[model samples]
Target: MQKTGIANLPLHSGKAPYWLFKRMVALSRAIVELMIIELGREELLRRLSDPYWFQCLGCVLGFDWHSSGVTTTVTGALKEALRGVEHEFGLFIAGGKAKKALQAPQEIINYAEYSGFAPQPFIYASRLSAKVDNVAVQDGFNLYHHTIVFTAEGHWCVIQQGMNETLQTARRYHWLSFTLKSFVEEPHEAVCCDVKIPALNFTAKEAADLRKAATILSCENPEKIIKEMKKIRELSLPERHMVSLSDINPENFYKIFLQTYEKQPSNFESLLEIKGVGAKTLRALALTCELLYGTPLSFKDPARFSFAHGGKDRTPYPVDRTLYDRTIEILKKAIEEAKVERSEKLAALRRLVKITQV
Candidate 1:
């Protein structure tokens, strides 16, 4: 799938109406069933990991295509639809908004026992993905919704959304287990946000030196690292700057400092696994790396989909009602027909080929 640019996702409040959501679940269940039958489970996971395809699927399923709520609502509908059918499809979904997000590890563990697969790695990826987006990518967005979809064979996909309170927008990050080689270096298949901001992204390839230096600082006596941070925090930016050193807190590093000192982290990823080693602490460490060791991290927005679909607020082009209705109708019909025996379903589905072509 072609990776598109980041699209706008306005923070839309309120739940999808009961009537519409029911239809969404029905239609999505059928669509996913057909997809798995035709393309296999791994291919389904790959498409879900593609932000553009996932967004389009949400629209085809009848949610507001450009609304941030689509990320949560679509995943919720899929979880409902996929239940009782996981064994046949080889896919399972875990985690969700708020409290549901906390259930992912245990959910994976349970699935592991049932499927006879190791749970630790899956659990680690689930937690690390959240940590990477929440802390490593220092965008202003705070993640409140997380979803993980995986097959019995261990292929997985994660679709998570974070909200920027000040901007009233949401950013969604996508990760594919099969495509990932390293968790720390540009691991995401795509990141979707409404707009760009000046954010510290320590995971960028340009930040290799900063990552190494931060690892070094984390391995040393946290107190010594703390002292180095103290010196950097003391440095002035310019003669007339709006922000001050007091605005930056080096003290937040104490928890990770103590943890790292007690059990030295062998590498940056290991340091990231420590509890309380979050954004502010990592940010301070990066600053310490730069100030003390002359190694700096990048401040680039890592979002890949920039030229994307129109926003709900009509920033680009308004939503095409005709296209939306046709999409829903096409999916609804194809799903309804797909429930039948092979011969009938094939004849009926071939008639809907024009629908999928779009």
Candidate 2:
């Protein structure tokens, strides 16, 4: 069967009329429960080996904007759900190790390198600010950004200030030393990106425009918004300057915007609806929120296909369609054997069948 394009599919967050949203949530809850009760843990693992099932899990685990997260919190939730279910099915049918079977979720998670966290070099907020000071005072005021994997072991920090090579060199070199060590341990993981987050200078008119947009999104509560705005202002000049300038590209811009607006949903929604908002910005905002304030945002990467293709290695793990089909078949038989009366199981099965239509 031909696979569907992700761009053409309705955004899960944007889908469903307000009235139907409640039903959608209810249906989602039912499906999760049904999977746990009937499919069993091992079976879920076996099924998850299928690319189609992996995508289904991704969609289920996903949130409003971020999709790549699938965080430790969510992973824990999935692990907990597997409780009370039999695991022998995964081992017997899938030929995976019994002891290591429990690690399937993490294994599945590891498949996508760029999707989530792997050790990487990061900049400290203080050092970054200092670098910005040097650059801001320099002739060109040029700032460079990169996402680099640390070659060594140390704390990975997010610089709230700016990135300047001189400042980077002057720092305790702790991060750099750590990065180097990481490289020696594993030569393959050492890499980085020269990512740039352009700065924006928010004009008075632009501020007013943002305010109006916020109002339309129902996020204009004066006192509350003022407090949040204060938090946004708490950032250093370079960071604030970045926000004001709207310096980031479409990818990182949304991340920067969310830093100021995540708590202010009205602002977040309005920004997303604006003409210029794009994938990078959305991801940036989500990551900024998650990494900075420890606030939870969406984890799913909105850009990638749910089926996990498009420059992706389609064969991350060997797919086991036979085990998946057998699991489904077992689930069908279990639905029949469910201690509950046949009528109730039938009704639940009906709901399960309807989920496919979605």
Candidate 3:
């Protein structure tokens, strides 16, 4: 770990200094890329898919936070993301007896405990450092974190930490999951996979409709969704009156479709006029459309991923570039220590440097 002057603060707080936090994030990307390079692509993917590694990496990712306030919030986000994906990627990573445990009705309880999401904050606070590496490599069969419960009914629930706020706190927040997915296709095309959704209470029908909306938004066709929304509007569905197609995914697939068909922007502006239909989604659509159908959209704005902080005297996080370089040098030395052939070492380093784009 490159020193960010962030390790010395209280680890359980929710208010980390902005500069240190930003620096840690930059260092994390470097570390993650380094690990990916060293492990090879196939192995790196496999490890990311593994639950043990995910938890380990997730925890270690949070280790840089000195503020207990920020640490708690960060931990909460990771836990929620893991919980939501448990049925999908999480299940695949666990197999055999581990798989059987997941199949149990009360598996959520078991997995939550196993995932270290229980109410013992004091324990988590104390164990943060030592358990970081252990959680990454331990097999579910060998050592269990929480007990598994197999109930008769299929519905699952976990003994998670209770939220301080009540469900009736805010109406707007109640329906918002806060899990926004950003799609970027540019020089280094990639998706910021599975950001954590915030805690919110939702009505049954609203939740079901939201899921359908998210599915539609995630689809490749914006015109199809527009057609479907228009039909819904025609039907006078109660929910349709309150919702807009923009709430789904805001990609203007119709812009090209319109030019080819009607030679105008009449149908295009209806979807484009929505509040959140900014440059981000437009760029995403442009890239996806071009890659899939060879129809390109115009460049809107410069792409960036930097998150500026307001509290720090504009100095964001201070990345120890010198330390990072030293770390890379040390890794090269490790390759030599392994007694690997010079040609092999050079080849490995070349591949590492290439994948990392370093």
Candidate 4:
């Protein structure tokens, strides 16, 4: 069974201090080496896809276990440390925060061809994963960092994070290639965060009809949406008619339709391929659908605990002792095998003690 838990990752600013960061790199390398040597690349990827395991990894590496920086700093350290060591682990890291993230497709291509595998599918997976989290999920967080690690044999894992500025929190989304059954339906291995807000998740099973309606709307002549925008714009308002499509200028919406009209997107994924389409435009269309077609949309957040061992507090359910013991044993074994200095190993153990305290 998979173990999962949400950790509060408040967005921390500035760089991770050089002293701490260097050790984090060392510790990270040790752990990854241990995972590869003992459990193998597939297991390593599987663990990285688990929110609880990933958080625990960040914690053990001596970062602010609960800081949003863990997602970035830990992945960054692994990227740097893993360089030139790909042969040993059979895993390659690609994509990253901002500029580095934009380099992912090319990075994947470079690595893939070098590793003797085709890059197109990997590239598509990378883009669609980002799109699903950023658009299909409709969560308020804005994704600013993305990191994908794939094995030479093609299994991959994604650990991307988005920031909720108003709340000073970051939500981390995990994806494992083998674990996902559908990109648009419960794609995450886990989504761990500090808070759960009312979010529009078009990708959710609960939003099936809403997604269908929205997709149907997208398939309609883009001209209709444009015409609807004109109607909303022309309608007299009671000082505040609370706008959606009204916020969109007809000319801009017309350009979006022009891009899609030619293709006539058969599905929501196809519609997303249209160049100018984006969240704001999608929101307008979804709202329009609700108003016109009365297709109900769920605002419920899809984030869940779904733990192997329930929360310590046991609100939803009691912790499963056997699974909890197994998780502890595996982590202990990895920590023991990590090839760091004696003092550093002791320090890592001490940090493990701090996990429960945190």
RMSD of each: 6.9, 21.8, 22.3, 11.3
Top model number, TM-score: 1
lDDT of 1 at 215: 88
lDDT of 1 by residue, 155-241 (tens): 899999999878988899999999898888988988887787877887888888888899888888767887887787668643321
Writing each residue's lDDT as its tens digit, candidate 3 over 1-358 gives: 0111112122132344554444435444444334434563344434432223433443343333222232233333333333444433222111112233233324444554655444232222112211211121111112112111111122111111111122211000000001111111111111111111221111122233322233234343546544543443344322322123344342344554333233322322232323343333433333333334444222221111111111122223444546645654565566455435556888999999999995
Positional deviation of residue 212's Cα in model 4 after best superposition, in angstroms? 2.3
Model 3 TM-score, all chains together: 0.24
Q: Which stretches of candidate 3 lie over 4 Å from their true place?
A: 1-38, 45-55, 61-234, 238-257, 260-336, 339-358
- Point to the candidate with the largest lDDT: 1
Q: Candidate 2's residue-wise lDDT over 1-358, tens digit each?
A: 1223332111111222332233223333334446545665434433433333443454443322222222111223333433332132121110012223333334333322333333222223222322322221121122232111111122221111112343221110111222223211111111111221232211112233333343232233334433444454444433332223233333333334444444454443234333333333433333333233444332111111222321011223333345434554555555546636657878999999999889
lDDT of 2: 0.30
Candidate 4 — which residues are off by over 4 angstroms?
1-6, 231-246, 305-358
TM-scores for every predicted model: 0.84, 0.21, 0.24, 0.79
lDDT of each: 0.79, 0.30, 0.29, 0.73
Segments of candidate 1 deviating more than 4 angstroms: 1-3, 238-252, 306-358
Question: Model 4 scores what on Cα lDDT?
Answer: 0.73
